[model samples]
Target: MSSTPPVPPVVEGGPAGSAPGGSQSGHAEHKFEKWQMKKIPTMWSRTWAHRGKISFGLFLAYSGVNIYYARKQQVIRDTIPQNTILHWRITDGSIVETDTDKGYFQKILRATGGDSPSPVSSLIDVITTIKRAKDDPRIVGIMANFSTANNKTQQTKTLGLAQIQELRSAIQEFKEAKAKALGGEDKVSLIAYTDSFDNQTQYYLASAFDKVYMQPSGSIPLVGLSSTVPFFKTLLGRFGIQVRAEARREYKSMVSPFTETELPPPQKQNLFDLLKGLNSQILADIAKSRQRALGSDPVEKLNHLIQVGPFMGSEAKDEGLVDGLLYKRDCGKLVESNGAFGLAHYMRVTAKEHTNKLAKTGEPSLVVGIVYLIGGIKRGGGDFGANTVVKGIREAANDPTVDAVVLRIDSGGGDVVASDTIGDAIRWCQDEKKKPVVVSFGNTSASGGYFVSTHAKAIIAQPTTITGSIGVASLRPYFTPEFFKLIGVSVEQFFTGSSDTSLLHDLEGAALTRYKRQIDATYSDFIKRVADGRKMTIEQVENVAGGRVMNGKEALKAGLVDKLGGLSYAVRLAGDYGLEVHKNAGHLSSDMEIENIVVKVFPTPKPYLQQIVESMVGDEAVDMYVRDKIHSMIMRVWTGDMMGLLHEVGLSESSFQNAPVSERILDTLDTELNPDNSDIPDTVEVDEFDEIVSGVESVKSLEHDCDIRALCIVGYTRRKSQSNNCCMRGVEDRRLRMLFEQM
Candidate 1:
């Protein structure tokens, strides 16, 4: 808080407002004295009468109105930002993720190293944000801001392979869409500009762009891919400590670290297979993207370039690893937009736009609720805390307005009980409510992740989505007498039952037998669920089980997923299923012609209180945060195309007769006019018919192959628009004339 006070307001007719050299005459001074004396009595009387309550109230009211509208105007301005270049920076901090609150704060404290908002590139953030930018006409291009050396927060040698792969996929999709949208003209440009490019993951991501610009004097080193794991069993033995774990199968590898000095053949084969697959995928993506950019086969070039470690900027360009060598300052000039802006500001504007749009279109738009199942699974319901995802699933299913559902799953699996609870909820939604539920995988969805998703209507995953770790294991810790003596602590156990409490201690005899049986039972159940959910045989599922993890492509071949695609593709599939349901219910036309239907997005405030307070927040940071939150909320409601979000609100063939008299007559006219259902009404009163003729005539004059009955239904249900109202008037005129002539 600052000590400074706001400047005072100007007073009328005071010396501060007057010319410097002026002086009042004696007669005029006497008049001023008389006026002041008269005003003093009234001022005192007013203060005494009401204690100045009304005066203070009026002042507050005036200030609040001004503040509120000022904020609103600022939001409006942010929404209409046009011809802007977004400078997006991907930082190490952005990619770092933690599941616990303590870890989140720890990451923030690490800021002593220097903290700036890095694009976290979490699956949804990277994929959806890039997708939004691709569709947003105002964004001309994007440049990867990878100059971390000068900044406090620095990226690690190797970025997360999963994040890099997801981002690269988004970039590729953006370019493809841009090309189609532009009709073979100049495409939406994507450029990678970095101080240095070292990590294989970083190289793979950068290679996806049209041009890769390396900072002059910077190097492209460390192009190799490898995995490292240290054996701690030897060290633990010297310390007189022991560790043990048991699994249902040999390939589980849960106890490998503590039980073996070196990886067994099976475990070694598993690790090698996963790594080989990932490395091949990275190499393939880099080659494909570079080939398109360089206009030649890049397989040989990339393979050769991989062997040469750490090339200078100029050398990298010559070797075809990079397109050019330039400084960050010059890279901005390449992909020219109408103007330049940071990506953060652009995000703020987009959120503001979404909030305003929802204020208007939210009621009518089909709700496609996206319930994100992030983090580990626990025994609570969804509230964005801990690992409660079941409640969110139930909430989406219970909403009457939701036409479809998308469950975005990103987890390595946890807590079988919680996982089963969610699975039951998903099954309930599909079996009882009959709403289509589509599951879209993110970075990881193995173990318990795959368990909860078994009952989904359709499962979709990215080509790189890590899935299918189908097996179970159990661990029991036993304390030795020496271990407690070294720690200077004593432990004791008591039992009340006659059967004994051996289950709490190290297993042996019958206790050990019971533990093994339990483990076996859980493993059997996991296998059964996979077989039933995936529509595979028990033998086939067993072949893929045993704690084996595979990427989406491999999982699809194993029948673990119905299809291999991203969230957007799954969303469209859900929408298709929803549309079919509405059609079957007679809410939509089987053959209704669709032309242009313009809807106003970016709505104004519909709530009375929100209007007063939303624009009044004095802090810019607070405003931006709130605005972005609003956008995130809207995006969750439905993340599909606008047309897919429209559901019938008023008249349908089944309900037309129950509608208002005017709507019923309009529906009759529509049915009579269409050849598909051209049966007209049998009985009509001529006098009543004449009265309705005038209404129909006005609608027929509109230059649209307008559905008059539909217009009449919407008139009673939806808010009126000037253009639509005018067309409605024209339709009434034409319809009446045509009806009278036919009579």
Candidate 2:
């Protein structure tokens, strides 16, 4: 009423006192405010609620899928019959012979992300399971799926021909024993499956099987043979990566790959001779299999087939290269259909039967032990390394029942010390236990692999087996200047003695001379070892010591091998030795410790929430991510070494697969020891007492009393230093102290 008294005039579009437009605008604002008030809260609540529901639903779905898959797998496993079919999946490198229930469990654990079990344990489990099934009356036949090839090189190197032959021999022996127990009936059938066969090593294995099947889409690449090594000196000239190499012998072609543009005349001639010999063997085997009189002319026929077109599955069968073309699933069905039960059902039922068979009939009264030396000859124990083989040999020697031993070697060599250790083990087995040892070559038993095998009583090799590489060489790239220039990384060293930290730098002048001298000494040791084992003069060993590659025929002629046979021949020799030992003895005990259980199981304590969180966010995650990064970086470095500029421009076939825990640990160790880092973690507290004691014992056994005394004195000095420091000493301290004071 008071404002009305002061009534003001309204303008056309001026303010609240204006005409129609002003009033309408005010009304529209009021309406919008009311609408927003009604809609905002409702929309916000719905979106938030729906998002949570969707997330929960997705989580439930993922859990359901995992549960369904797990249950289905369990049901399938339970439904399968026992002792039906044994599927041996051959994995290269750390190939575990998983044919037993325990082996299966271990493999499943490894596949799922559990601690990896040792390869021997896996093999032992398979053997135990097979033995148990063999004794079960419900079991009918045994079948195997062999997919491993001896030639495929791994991180550990290729499987030696001797090892493959031994494995084949062992399988045969097991089959024969099972058949005899089953009233002389052939209840076992060996079946091999592969995409195609090319190398002589694989072909030899396929020939052992009762029936070999090839995939319809796969071609048996049975082209004669060729070994090509393209030198890249010219290619690298453009990039300025000059390669300097030296070798002792004219035939040594190990350095040819990096130095030459193509094979040298002598290398070419050697390869041609090797190809001619290998081709003859391949044709002979094919002719025997197909019942054809094909001779050296088979190469021409093979060439004609390739020129026409890529052969299909049925075409391969028609050409007599394969027995039949079948899909993997169809092959499984065929195996199942032949028996009274289905494949899955048979596997379940027969698994139990075989387990019982293996248990009842243990190893024979006179045990003939066979040690598998497969893969690269690494320094450490486990799998196909030198330490593993040596350990196995020692175990066999200690066993009174083990009258003879067979070494199945398949490798291209690795560390020199590892090879020497294995050789020493073999010598110990022969001299101490007086056990006759036979060696069988599978694919390639060259260098360190051959070094160990030369100590055996008899050596057997396949026709295509590659042997002989008595040489030593090493290459280490230096990135000091490059890394400093590219990244701001820097390194400095302080030394108190001559040659201190010398190995850390590039090899040049005095350093290079020292390195060469070390290599020569190692080479001399290698030659001496071979000469001792082969009972030849050092001069004779030197003739073949310059890293010369030899096929089985040439190796045999050179007195590197004694027989042209497989693992079976080696085992048979072992059995003969065992029989001889038994005959010489008055009586033998019936009971024997056939197996030793080395596996242990314990329940894992529930992890605390904090522990789990820390593991996820702390060192573990950093370790994993950093390791993967480093592995990729290292692989890139290696590719650079192998392909030079090609890799730099992304034209090389280099890859970094999932990084392993071991690689990560190595990276962490490398980082911690980096020279630029001032604060290095103290590793002195680690309890390496057992390792020290073991090393001392091993040295005593390998060397003279004078050497043992020297080692003991060195150990005393190191112990005194550690006592004085009050701080823990590490591997470096022990190594350096030993070097200065002892051998």
TM-score of each model, paired residue for residue: 0.66, 0.54
The digit string of per-residue lDDT tens for model 1 on 1-743 reads: 67987766555565564543344565588898998999989998987787678778888899889889998987665653565566777655454322221233334544445656353333444455677777887776677777663344543423456556667778877787777775652656677889886455667777888778988888876365667767877776655456546775767766677777988887788878877777677777877877754446676666666677768887877777788888877887785644566665666566556567767665334556676676777764233322235545655665666677888787888788778877887887788777888888877888888998887888998777778878886655445566677778787777675322343255678866777888899999999988888788899999989988788889989889998777656666777776667778898888643221111111111232222233344234433444454434433432331122122323343443354544544554454333386332333332333334435645453233334443442332222223233222223322232222232
Off by over 4 Å in 1: 1-83, 93-129, 135-137, 149-163, 180-187, 292-297, 307-312, 335-337, 351-364, 380-387, 485-505, 585-743
Candidate 2 Cα misplacement greater than 4 A, ranges:
1-106, 109-218, 226-244, 292-309, 322-364, 381-386, 476-514, 579-743
lDDT per residue, candidate 2, 1-743, as tens digits? 35546677767567756765777799899999998999898898887879988889999999999999999997776553544555544333333422212334344444554233223223333434444445545455544443433323322233334344444544555566667866663456556676655454555445545566777666555545556566666665554345556654556676777777777787677667777776666555455544442334654565565455445667767765557777677667756744333333343455555456557865334456767776788876344556556657766776655778878776778877888887888787888678888887767788888877777888888777888887776554344454454556676767777642353356689877876788788877778877877899988888776777788888888878888876545566676665665556644434332232211111111133323333446534533444444444443443333243223323332321122322332233334333375444334221243233334443243212222322332233333344454222333333332232221
The backbone clash count of each candidate, in order, is 19, 40
For model 1, what is the C-alpha lDDT against the true structure? 0.63
Task: Report lDDT per candidate.
Answer: 0.63, 0.57
Candidate 1: residue 443 lDDT (0-100): 72
- lDDT for 101 in candidate 2 is 23
